[model samples]
Target: MATVCISGALVDKLRACAEAGFDGVEVFEPDLVSAPESPEEIRALAARLGLTLDLYQPMRDVEGVDDAEFARVLRRAEAKFRLMRRLGVDVVLCCSNVATATIDDDEVSARQLRALGDLAAEHGIRIAFEALAWGRYIDDYRRAWRVVELAAHPAVGVCLDSFHILSRGHDPAGIREIPGERIFFVQLADAPRMELDVLSWSRHHRLFPGEGSFDLVGFVGHVLHAGYAGPLSLEVFNDTFRQTDPARTAAQARRSLRHLEDAVARADPSLTGLEMLPDSAAPSGFDFVEIIAEDTSTIEHLLARAGFTSRGRHRTKPVTLWSAGRARVVLNEQHARGRTPYLAAIGFEVDDASAMSRRVAALRTPRAYRRTYDAEEELEAAVAPGGTEVFWAQAADEGEPAWVSEFEHGGPRIASPVTGIDHVSLTEPWQVIDESALFYTATFGLRTVSATDVPGPQGLVQSRVLAGPDEVVRLPLNVAPPILAERGGPAALSAHVAFSCADVRALARAAHLRGLDILPIPANYYEDLAARVDLDDDVLAELRELNLVYDRTDAGEYLHVYTATIGNVFFEFVERRGDYAGFGAGNAPVRLNAQSASSAARESGGFGRVRA
Candidate 1:
C-alpha cells in the first residue's frame, strides 16, 4: 500500500496497512515530513507493527537539469538518502524531472542520475527512477529505462508505474525488454480513461487495480515475464480515498491486489508460483431481493398490485416472502422500526453457494451480520461497499430451495406474468461508486458495460452497469449529481428493482386496473416518443394511458412501467422484445422528471408546483 493512497495520520496509515495485511508500504515524502515522530521512531514503530518500510519517495526533478541545478539535486539527494537510512528503507523513488528540466538530452539526465546514485551508494540507498506521465521529458517508462541503462550505476534501477505507462497509451509489452533485476520497484495504480492532463488525473483519479478500465492482468504478466519479483505495491492518489476512512481504504487496496493476483494467475497458468483466490463465477440469476421497512403494509400493497402473492412469512423473524412466478421479494420489518423502506439484501442463484462464499472471504469482503435461528439456513452474505448485503443461493436440482421451508405458507400461490428480476438499480453514495463497481467485478466476476449519463430533474446522473455472463444478471449502479447528492444523495431520489415479463403493456394495464398508483407519464413524453420512434397510433395511446415508457433500437424494442415511490424504494416492470438488452435509458429523463414531480405533489398535498 502507498501512504498517500490512505487518509489519516502517518501512524494511523501504517496501522491500517498492517491491519489490512499489507507486507509493506511506500512512504510518501509529505506524510513522512508531516509526522511528529522522528524518522528512526517511525522505523521502530513499523518494525513493531510488522510492516516493512519498503520505499521512501520521492525525490523529484533530480534529472534533466544543468550542472549547477544537478549539484543542488545531488545535495538534496544526499539528504533524502540519509533520511531513508534513518527510516530503514533502502529504495528511494526518483521521479523524472517535470518542472526543472532545462536539458532534454537522455545522457545528461543519465549522468545526473549516476551522480545522484553515487551519492546514494555511500548511504547504501538504491535509486528507483520513475517516469512521471507529465514529465518535461523522460515521461515514458521505456525512456526512463533507457536513462537507467545509460546511467550504468549499480545502485540505480528503473521503477515501473502502471499509471505512468498505461495512461500515456504506451505498450506495457516493452517492459520485457528491461531485465527484471534492473526493475528495482513496481508501483501499481489503475485509472478510468479520461481526457485531462496526466498530472491532474494522476493526483486525483487513480484507482486500485480491477477498479478501472486498464488491462492490469496483461500489464503485470509482462512484468512477471521479465522476472520482476518485488512487492506489487499500490500507489493510488484518489480524492475519495484521501478523505475516506484509512482502514477501510487500506482493506480495499489489499483486496484489489489480491483480486489482481488472482486475475493474473488465471490469465496465465504457467506462472505456477503466483497465488490464486477462489474463482468467482457469474451468478445464474437473482433469487430474491430483501427490503427493510418500518411500515410493511405499503410495500405489501404495492407488491399485491403488481401481481405478487404472499408466499409465506419467516417462522423465526419478522420477514415475509412474496412471489410472482420466479420473481421473489422479501420484506423484513426486524430492526427497521423507524427507517423508510430500502433495499437491504440481494440473493443470487448460483451453481455453488459455498464456493461463492469462499471467494467472498478470499476477497476480504466484510461478511454481513445475519441473525439466524439454530435450524434456519446458513445464508452467508457479503456486504457491498454501498452497504447492500449480497447472498448466494445454490440452485437445487429438484424441489424448492431449502431456505423456503423456513417461511410458512401464507396462502395459495398466485400466477403472474412477472418471470423474475430483470435488474436492480442501486443508487450509490457518491464516494463509493468506483469501489462498488470493483467490488461487484471482483466478487461475482461481473463485467462493466459502457456507462451513461442520464439527465435527471435534479441534474445529470452518472450510471454504470455491470452484467453477469450472457447478461443473466444486470445491476445498474447510479450516482446522483453533486447538487442532489449534497442534499441527500441518489438514495433520496430512489433505488428500484425491475421485474421482467413477457408483455409489459399487459402487466402495466393489469397494474393500473388493480390501482397500483402507477407513476404518471406526462402527455409531452408520449408526444416526444412519437417523434423519436415510428409506433402505431393505438399502441402509443395505450402507452400514454398506462404511463408506460418505450424505447427501441434496430435490434429490438423495450417497454417498462414504474410505480410511485414508496419510501426510498420503487418498482419497475419491463418487457424485452428481440434482443433489447438496455435499461430503457432513453426514457430515463422522462421517468426522473415524473418521479420528481410526483414527489413534489405528494409533499404539497397533490397540488404540485409546476416544473418548467
Candidate 2:
C-alpha cells in the first residue's frame, strides 16, 4: 500500500497497513517528511509491525535537464538516498521531469539517469524510473523504457504504474517486451473514467482495483507474464479515502488486492503468484428480504394493506414471516429495541451455498453474526459495505427454503398479484457508495448496468445499479446529495424493496380499496406525463387517480407506486411489460418531491397518519 492512500499520523498508517496483512508499503515522500518520528525510528516501528519499507518515493523531475540542473538534481537525489538508508529502503522512485526539463532528448535524459544511478549505487539504492502521465517529455512507459535501456546502468530500472500507463490509453501488451529484471517495482491503482485533466484526476479520483472501470486483471497478467516478481503495492490518491479511518481504509485496500489477484488467477490459469479463490456464480433469485424495527405495527399494517399475509412467527425468535406470492419478508425484532424500521438484510437463493460462503471468507469480507438453534439451518451471511446483511441459502426439496419451516403458517394464504422481489434500493453513505458498488460486483459477480443522477429536492442523487445474471437480482444503490446527507437523521435515510407483478393497475386499485397509504403525486406530474407519454385518456386518468408513476422505452413500459416512508424504509410495487429492464429512474424526481413534502408535513405535525 502507498502511504498517501490513507490518512493518519505516518506511524499509525503503517500499523494499519500491517494489520491489513500487507507485507510491505511504498513510503510516499510527503508522508515521511510530515511525520514526527526520525527516519530510524520509523524504520524500527515498521520492523516491530512486520512491515518492510519497500520504496522511498518520489524523487521528482530528476532527468531531462541541463548539466547544471542535472548537478542540482543529483544533490537532491543523494539526500533522499541518505534518508532511504535510515528508513531501511533500497528502491527510490524517480519520476520523469515534469517542471524542470529544458531538453526533450531521450539521450540527455538517459545520460542524466545513468549519473543519478551511479550516485544511487554508492548508497546501495536502485533507481526506479517512472513516466508521469503528464510529464513534460518522457510521459509514456515505452519512452521511459527506451531511456532506461539507453542508461545501461545496473541500478536503474523502469517502474510500471497502472494509472500512468492505462490512464493514457497505452497498450499494456507492450509490457512483455521489457525484460523482467529491468522492471523494479509495480504500483497499481484503478480509477473511474472521468472528464478531467490527468493531474487532477490522478490526485483526486483514483479508486481501488475492482471499484473502477480499468481492465486491471489483464494489466496485471501482462506484468506477471513478463516475470516481474514484486509486491503489488497500491498508490491511490482518493479524496474520500484520505479522510476515512485508516484501519478501515487499509482493510478495504487489502480486500481490493485480493479480489484483483483472484480475478487474474481465474482469467488465466497460467498466471503465477496469484491465489485462486472458490468460484462464485450469480445467485438464482432473492430468497427473502429482512427488515428490523422496534415498533413493527406500522410496517405490519402497511404490508397487510398491500396484500401480504402473515405467514407465521419464528419458532424460537423475535421474528415473523410475511409473504405475498413469491415475495417473502422476515421481520426481525431481536435487535430492534433502539433501532428504527430499516431494510436490514437480504437473502439470496444460490446454487451452492457452501462454495459462496467459502468464497466470501477468502475475500476477507466481514461476517454478519446470527444465532441459530441446533435444529435450524445455519445460514452464512456477510455484511455489505453499506451495513446490509447478505445471506445465502439453498432451496429445499419442496422448492422453498428450508428456513421457511421455522415459521409456522398461522392462517390460510391470501392470493396477491405481487410476484417476487423486483429490486432492492439502498441509500449508501457518500463515502462507501463506490465501495459498495465494488463489493456487490466482486463478491457476488453482479454487473454494473448504469450510473445516473436523479434530481432530488435538495440536489442530484447519484444512483448506480448492479444486476445479476438474466437480471434476476437488481440492486439500485443510491448516494444522497451532500446537503441532504449533511442533515443527518432518520429523515435523511431512504431505502425500499420493490416487488414485481403482472398487472400494476389492478394491484394499485386493489391496494387503494385495501386502504394503502400511498404517496400523493402532484396532478401537474400527470399533466406533464400526458404531454410526453402516449398514454390513452383512461390509462392516464387511472395512473393519476391511483398515484402511480410510469416510464416508457422503445421496447416496453413500466408502472410503479410507492408507499409513504415508515421510518427509513418504504415499499414499492412495480410492473414491467414487454422486456422492460429499467427501475423507472425517470420517475425518481417526482417520488423524491412527494416524499420530501410528506416528511416535512409530518415533522410539522400538520399531516395525520395516513393509515388503514
lDDT of 2 by residue, 1-612 (tens): 999999998998999999989999999999989999999999999999999999988889998888888889878888888889989999999999899999999999999999988999999999999999999998899999999999999999999999999999999999999998899999999999999999999999999999998999999999999989887899999999999999989989998999899999999998766788788788888999999998788898888888888988889998989998779998988878888888999998888888898889888888998888899988989999889999998755455787888888566777789999999999999999888987888788898899999987888889999999799999999999888888853333688999998788788888888788888888899999999988899989888888889999988989999888988898999999998999888889888988888888888986533333
Clashing pairs in 2: none
Write one digit per residue (lDDT tens) for candidate 1, span 1-612.
889998999999999999999999999999999999999999999999999998988888999888888888877887788788889999999999889999989999898889888889999989999999899988899999989999999999999999999999999999999899999999999999899988899999999998888889999999999999988899999999999999999999999999999989989998867888876579988888999998788999989888898978899888999988778899999989799889989988889888898898888899987878789888888999999999988977776578888888777876688988999999988889988998999899898986999998778889999999889899999988888877763333588999999888778777777778888889999898899888999999888777788988888988898888878899999999999889889889888888888877787789322111
List residue ranges in candidate 1 displaced over 4 A: 489-492, 607-612
Model 2 alpha-carbon miss at residue 62, Å: 0.6
What TM-score, over all chains together, does every model reach?
Answer: 0.97, 0.97
RMSD of each: 2.1, 1.7
Top candidate by lDDT? 2
Q: Number of clashes in model 2? A: 0
